[model samples]
Target: MDLGIIGQAAGLFAVTNIDDILILALFFARGAGHPGSTRRIVLGQYLGFTAILAVAVAAAFGATFLPESAVPYLGLLPLALGLKAARQAWKSHRNGAGDQEDTRAEPGGGPGALEVAAVTFANGGDNIGVYVPVFATAGIGGMTAYAVVFLVLVAVWCFAGRFFATRPVVARALARWGHVLLPLVLIGIGLLILVEGGAFGL
Candidate 1:
């Protein structure tokens, strides 16, 4: 196994899925004190993420049929997404809303595993956009490595979310920094993809 490829896979997963931590934290927060809520949340997360990966993998397989020269154009997806996220963050900051906590009311009952899975899948639009191009570019071995790393990281993300449920301070910090960090990392990844792919002669 190539350590460099593993590191790249880890980095890709980290940047693309950073926003999930906040959502997971919220889910864990709401599910607290409900019987078996934790189990359901984790299971739902896995189910949803697996579905997302399946779609990405399938799409990537299709992407492989595209002209090699055109494949690099897929980098535009992440670049656009990063710019959009950055714009939103800037707007929120200008409106003095960047630091505001999520104040949405918790649902009446613990969300079932399927319900959580739905939400997770719903939130994965960006994931698909990013994953498809990356997976298409990665060969089978590299893609397998990425998949394994992603699955392992899902557990870590779940643990972090659960921990943040009990630690509002840490969660708040994540919220504050995440807005700043997410866009930067995404943009960087976008550029890396484009440059490495020699997109537009860059």
Candidate 2:
């Protein structure tokens, strides 16, 4: 089942997801004020995400359980996060913050590898759910494939997140109202999580 690896990877993926979220936020900040690069963001996405996931997978190796009970609650997090994102994007548009909104938005050109790492570390909230307890339990044999699933998932998401952030259509949509949708989806999942929390938490 590769459960062990999967558990570990899950935690790492969660953290990476959080980094991407922050990257998106910065994308807007730069677009309106500074102007970050696609390469730097992508590189950064990989950095913070890779490190966290690595540790998580390793942890899953000889442990028992990673608190699968939190899965439901974790599931809801995405929806809430997405919705909130959309709302903010919409508000930015309404306010006509304009590309030249704030000097603070000034992007630090060339998001070099180190910069990427810094950004990844800076955005950890997004991974709070699946990241922490993903493999907190016990029982596991060979977990190579399990970890791969999560590693791949997070890696892909980070790539896409950065790519999308730099896209004109995506940026415009986000500026218009994408954050709202993201958060609402999270809300729905949150409700489901609540149910899980009440019923079979495991």
Candidate 3:
């Protein structure tokens, strides 16, 4: 195992995924009233990130067989997701719900693992852009090392997010500001991905 590759992968994942901490923290705070929310969040994050990793691996291996140029256009996925989030937030505001997250509660009907996974995937679609290039260049050994480290770091991220939400100040702020910030963050991520991927010459 190359410690260099492992260290690099860990750092990259941690840096690129800092926004995930905020999202997870919101989830933790919102779901605090619901039992098993933490478990669902953990499972959902893993499922979502695994999908991203699978796509990276596929793109890496299929680089020769596929059009590499099309990879950048994959930014559309996040762009669409961000738009959808904005629409939802708008609808929530129009409906006078004030906060979408607060409006989603139900007795034993909180967001499921799949719901969280979907949000995770949408939020992290840009990971494909970053991961695919790294994976393609890393070869199988380095890819494996990156994957192991990334997954471990993901668990650590989840724990940290949950911990952050436990703070009274953070929890109150998230509750007050998270709905508005979430959509804007998603849109910003989409634009960043597009620019980084050189999509449409951006």
Candidate 4:
């Protein structure tokens, strides 16, 4: 394994994925008391990231698995999720559930793995754009090396998110405001993705 390739892969992954830390932290905060939440979150992240990589690799090889024009529309995934979360929060507040609702077990264990994966993939539009060119230039060996490093780094990223969410002050704050902020954050990210990608010509 060439050190240069390893370094380049690490740099690319770091640049593309720095934003993921906050998103993952919010997820951990939301799922703090739930059993198996950590596993689900991590699994979802890998699933989503793997999908992104697959698409990038396919694109790099001149395979038209996903049209470039459709990339921006991926924002819809997070947008819909945000709207759903917001509606649920509003109903909970209207019903006076308040803080108690925060710890309530969701119907399917508080955000299924697929739900998390959707958000992860939605947030990765830029990752796909950046990765395609690099993957195109890298041969088989190089691509394999990059993939291994990327997967390892995903675990590190998850650990960092979990660590941040577990902090005393951060946890308290998230416990209080996570429900409110989660929807807003997801909405904001969705809009940003749409606008940045020029989705719907916005």
Top-scoring candidate (lDDT): 4
lDDT values for all models: 0.71, 0.50, 0.76, 0.86
Sort order, lDDT high to low: 4, 3, 1, 2
Mind giving the per-residue lDDT tens digits that candidate 3 earns over 23-125?
7886676567676788998998899898878877888887443355765555565566558757866787787864644646544544457766766776666
Model 4, residue 28: what's the lDDT?
89
State which candidate, 2 or 3, has the greater TM-score. 3
| lDDT of candidate model 1 versus the reference | 0.71
Candidate 2: C-alpha lDDT: 0.50
Ranking by TM-score: 4, 3, 1, 2
- Candidate 4 structure quality by residue, lDDT tens digits, 1-202: 8999999999999999998998888888877767888899999999999998888888888897988888888888988988998997787778786555555665445666898899999899889889988888898889889998999999999999999889999889887787788888889889988998898989
**Residue 79 lDDT (model 1):** 64
What tens digits encode model 1's per-residue C-alpha lDDT throughout 1-202? 7898889888988897787786677667646656688899999989988987887888899843335575555556556655876786687677675233332223444546875675565456457778888888998988898899998999999998889867878656645576665556556656766787798899
Best by TM-score: 4
In angstroms, what RMSD does candidate 3 have relative to the true structure?
A: 3.8
TM-score of every prediction relative to native = 0.61, 0.42, 0.73, 0.93
